[model samples]
Target: MRTVLVLTVSLLLFSCSPDTDDERIGISGDSFLIFGHFFGECIGEGCVETFKLTESQLLEDTIDDYSGQQLNFEVLSDALYQQVRDLPDFFPLELLNEKEAVIGCPDCADGGGLFIVYSKNGTQQSWRIDQSKGNVPVYLHDFIDQVNARIALINQ
Candidate 1:
């Protein structure tokens, strides 16, 4: 009887313990999205604007370079963050499965370019999209518009 009680208690304790599997924990983790626009020939602080959006906060990249390769971020004000917090939800899932990381000639002619990085379920994908509507896939036009609109909103 004592052995049975001990076994039952041990089983209960193990069952109640939090899961420690990294894969399982990662599955429930919040996804992250990073997006921004850059103009190689532009001047001014707004020339290269980028942002990182998480499940709870919006962060603006402090780096002012035209490349999105490296970025550092600072949290934006709650009011401003709220305005673009839903931006991640608008990311098209099809882009994740795309074979091309770059859709068109971004910033090839002094035209601005859009940059995007999406992370979910332990997978990450990024893209460099042309600012010219005709230069990008038709499906991405709406998302580009949304991105431009949000950029304007924050800059305002």
Candidate 2:
């Protein structure tokens, strides 16, 4: 009897979930929404680059990594991001520095996105780059290597 009641309730609840499209909280002030988890889809005008967000687990997986804080959309930061984007969980942040990090948003309004800040120890940085243009995420290790390579290329 209990099982039947549980099933009935579960069915009712799932049936009630809105059937338009699954929505994602966009980076800048919630104007854009991702309806699905597209492993290689390009968004925003600034980046024609495709994203592999399987690791961020933006869809689910509690215990946000970077900060080990309760995950919430409006308040998520690099602390939580480390968790959200941990390898195999999702994709790790795409940018890093010696003591800081800047997680990029591929697409944002007007080709201007934002950055999530973090320290070298992987703690979330209080400062964030909001709605910046030209800066973008491109996978952490690759981004760092390229930056160094660019300097070398210039020297040569």
Candidate 3:
């Protein structure tokens, strides 16, 4: 009888573990991508636009703050999500292994700046890339273009 009871308790404990539940898996478990552009010198509603893209949904920062640190997010409309659904596909794999978090001087000349935060598996990395084509690495050109296009689509 004691053996039976122990088995049942073990089963229950294992079942309740977070690893056993698929629905419990969230942004932390899977990959999440955050991309945005900020202009420190600019004023108005369009100056700061940031987005968090998860496997299941897309969220936009409601605070509109210039900093790329922690920002509040709200789920974007389904229509808006669709417009940038492929944005993640454009991410450069090389960036995942890059050491520098800040590439070149971002927004140094008021030319604006782009930021990306990508988390996958157990690694989370962020980068602040210069808006100018010449300032950033050549590998990031296509990704930057794609980001810009998606941002335009979302704003439209």
Best by lDDT: 3
Candidate 3 lDDT trough over 10 residues, lowest sum = 19-28
Clashes of each: 0, 12, 0
Residue-level lDDT of model 2, residues 1-156, one tens digit each, is 999999999999988866422222123322221111111134543222111122232332233222223333333344433432422212133222324332344223443222233332323332223133345333444433332232233223
24-94: candidate 1 lDDT, tens digit per residue? 21212567788889898887888899987777778899876577877889999888878987675566656
131, model 1: CA deviation in Å?
Answer: 0.7
**Model 2: how far is 138 from its true place, Å?**
9.6
lDDT (tens digit, per residue) of candidate 3 on 12-111: 9987756433322234448888899999899888798999888778899998877776699999888888788777667777777689998878899998
What TM-score does model 1 achieve against the real structure? 0.78
Off by over 4 Å in 3: 1-29
TM-scores for every candidate against the unseen true structure: 0.78, 0.20, 0.78
Give the Cα lDDT of each candidate. Answer: 0.80, 0.31, 0.83
In candidate 3, the residue pairs with backbone N, CA or C atoms under 3 Å apart (3 or more residues apart, or in different chains) clash, namely none
| 71 Cα displacement, candidate 1 (Å) | 1.0
